[model samples]
Target: MTPIQALYYFVEARPTRTGPPNVGIGAILLIVAAAVFIAWVAWLWIAARPSSGGEETALNLQPYLSDDELETTKLNRVLRAAM
Candidate 1:
């Protein structure tokens, strides 16, 4: 046999059937990235939801009424009639 072939056999450096070593690491990194992205989207969705506080004020009916006729009972009646 040639010297090169003999040397190769002595070193026992055979071809590998598996792919590159970094392939598994790359897959794991992609999975982690997907998880992080999903978590961020979910956080944004939750933060955008309306709160259950009583801070939402009703539309001012006083604008449609005159100064002399400005009354809550009158406004409620007018609103009910309009609706």
Candidate 2:
């Protein structure tokens, strides 16, 4: 017999057990939960990483402005936006 057919027959030849079938259900749920947890962690890790592009670096202006100047700039921006 071919390996595939032999393996199939081996799987089909297992004796049936008379008991509550909760083990299979619990195993399936555990696998699903682990998959979901892994996906969530992967998403969080990806999102927490800084982008490789220059956009974020270009937007940083803290080094060029004093506190007072920053506050004034903010006020001016708000006033301009209000108009």
Best by lDDT: 2
Model 2 TM-score, all chains together:
0.40
TM-score of each: 0.39, 0.40
Return the TM-score for candidate 1, rounded to 2 decimals: 0.39
Residue-by-residue lDDT tens digits, candidate 1, 1-83: 99999998977877766766866887999999999999999999999999989675667833566655766768778999999
Could you tell me how far off, in angstroms, the CA of residue 83 lies in candidate 1 after the best superposition? 60
Q: Candidate 1 local accuracy as lDDT?
A: 0.84
What C-alpha lDDT do the candidate models reach, one value each? Answer: 0.84, 0.89
Please list all clashing residue pairs in model 1, or write none if there are none: none
Error of 2 at 43 (Å): 0.6
Model 2 lDDT per residue over 1-83, tens place: 99999999999999987997866888999999999999999999999999878655455654777889878988799989999
